[model samples]
Target: MSRIPQLVIANGTVVNSFGRRHAHIVVVDGKISQLVDATEPVPDAERTIDATGQLVIPGGVDGHCHVAQVTGRFRTLDDYRTTSTAALWGGTTTIIDFGIPRDARETPLEAVLSKKALAQESRCDVALHGSVVRWDETVPWQLEQLAAEGVRSVKMYTTNRGTTMADGDTILKVMREMVRLDGLTYIHAEHDPIIADCTAQHADDGRIGIEHLHRTRPELAEETSVKETLAMAQYTKAPVYFVHQSTPGAVDLVTEARARGQEAYSETCPHYLTLDDTVYGSAFPEWYACCPPMRSPETVAALKQRLAGGAIHTVASDHSCYDLTQKRERTDDVRAMPHGLPGVETRMPVTFTAMAEAGSSVEDFVEVFAAGPARINALPGKGSVAEGFDADLVLFDPSVQRTVDGGALHMGTDFSPFDGRTLAGWPAVVVSAGRVVLDREGFHDPGAVGRFVSRNGFREHLAATADLSAATL
Candidate 1:
């Protein structure tokens, strides 16, 4: 007979994909087996966690994070161990990180395998999004192979340094191929030509301040790129996802595209919704810098409304952190600093506060943070806390208040843009696969049995529940 480790999370309000309600969740054999009334008696099992007056919700699924990836001369501060530790502390149990190809050396699969190997000892579960650098004939075959190995998503860049931009024909080909394979294509939307033109113009005019970063990129750049990507999605009938959408114009484009029955979805980061161009004018502007630069306060408010109305599907940190030494070097020259922010540990709490301030329900948070990301990644047994789902849960104290301090966070980053800001609703207890990984004190351990998840057989599963109409918007 096999032994069952039975544990009961008693007297807590259970928040799942459906919604939040008071219930006692029973965990047996590392899976949620039953949900009973909050006052239910604990069965004869291993242990019982009293979650009175706390919200027991599904562990967060961070759909976008950059762990152990490098850019230019600066390497990311958080590796698998550190990043996963920070994630666990923040109640995020699963991560979908990017796997960028090395410069002209290894194949996509080879690069993914190397990242997988590096993340083998992660403290939390992980998945990969195979980033396509130079799209070519051989790329499709490599993608198919990656899909076979459980890598279901491919990332294509529209504008970046030293990266090949996929023209219309190439984008159409890749989109069609992904649709045929029942996979997803994630796009970094920014018009290359417009951005190049703007950058050159700004350089010539000597208007290269941190504020000029937004001018060079501009809202039109994002809008044009988003419109183009939506058109391609319509042309090829592929499920398209826009990563880190930053402006109102881009949001409007996605809203219109979804109305047309196109499969277009978008994810906006915390930085875009919280920070703005004023950060660029701050004494330490480099700390708040990122691609698709933050827009005006009006754009941020619009993003908040979109999120509340379900116009936006997902929220991610885009948690890419680099040390101060490298970040400051770009302060003098806005283009030199790597584009990213350190946010894996803060994505959840910050969003929760923002939504709560807007009178949004916990259902809204669950939909955007947990369910939407899992569905996008095609991961089963995740995104929910119902019976038969993985026992990944977070116990939140809605009244707990804390100030954001980057130096105090567990990630390897040296600072945080959100520093000194106070927020409410923090995770008091975190459980991953029926095991406690983080509590009020800190992480349980550095190497606590995190695993690399394979993407095999995910497409068929997603196809069964995929609402093509809902996916596009």
Candidate 2:
């Protein structure tokens, strides 16, 4: 026990999802040692930092990030190294990415394996969610292998039709398999028929451009799809998670299901929480061309209200990095454009601002920013600041602010969705795996590669250990 205290962070307010405490944090071998009371003697350590006025919080966990991800004709520009580094800068030490099959011929297991190999280049820890576009006799075996790989969640689309969508039969069969494996099922919920019909009508009227995106994908489609997916989840008793939920009605459906003893979760992105459909009318409409595009101002406000009410489980960046040129290339046709926004570096500030505007507390922000994602995703060592947890933590001023400049950021993109807006909650110092990765001086990469974290199964681990609702949100 000679190295019992290798590092010490003194005099900071340690914040948790449920509470906060003024304590000194001690670290040993990359895991938290303990939180020594201020009245107690400071534990001897090899290094110590005086964080007099900063808030020491668990490093952020971004559950929806796209790195070097391919979509249609274009691919996101950033790789594991770039995105993870940017995540550290933003106080997010752990990021969960999707292993979606590039084509129908590529097996789900193959996609997950490829992502794991690429994730080795990350400077921060990484986890993956596997995806399936179809169900064959071999899919059950592929899922078993995915669980063995620690990628426990599987994603499917209900709206992409021939390209990425899995029909109702495939979806139900996959949910049953996920339940058998004690894993979670993730759905991109948007009614396929509604979206297809709306897009066709827009095309007929010559209004299928990015500027008409919000109208093309209406909120009713999302609410309807959510209800359908929840029904399936309830029928199969499978734990289901809806990603990038953009409407309050959709979140309410999940909330009501949870009340009925169903395992359901709703995750909304920073874009849906802060930005509105007005971006479609702006000159740079292509910048907001993601599927299930930004909703109206009324919808945005209502979604924020849901988050404040604790109906939303997690707030993710949904970070997709495409340069301005790729976005410009397909501005004329929304269907052909690359979808997603560059916001990994801005998730902390943006979410903080949104919740603050909603009159929520820091404890609530802590819930969505770090704890909720870790708990729902079965990441045991990544979320809390308590003893034996990972020493991935950030020190920051809660009231400090900075205006965003997309070019000045590090996601390897040329623009930001929240450009020109001032935001708070920027990180001052970031520690990951017991190393001071970012501080006032600069970032210290030093050839550190992030580990691929294996997640725990729901029934095998979570149901036996914690409350489902508390663990999820």
Judging by lDDT against the true structure, name the best candidate.
Answer: 2
lDDT of 1 by residue, 114-138 (tens): 8888888788899898877765779
> Who wins the TM-score comparison?
2
Residue 373, candidate 1: how far off, in angstroms? Answer: 0.3
Candidate 2 overall lDDT versus native = 0.90
lDDT of 2 by residue, 1-473 (tens): 35557789998988888788888999988899789986677788888987878999999999999889987778899999999999998999999999999887789999989989998899999999999999899999999999998989999999987778999998999999999998999999999999999999999999988899999999999999999999999999999999999999999999999999999999999999988999999989987888789998999999999999999999999899998999999788888888889889899999999999999998899989998899889897877888878999999998899999888999999999999999989999999999998888988883546989999997666653365336534
Candidate 2, which segments miss by more than 4 Å at Cα? 464-473
Candidate 2 residue pairs in clash (backbone atoms < 3 Å): none
**lDDT, residue 282, model 1:** 79
- TM-score of each model, in listed order: 0.95, 0.97
205, model 1: CA deviation in Å? 1.9
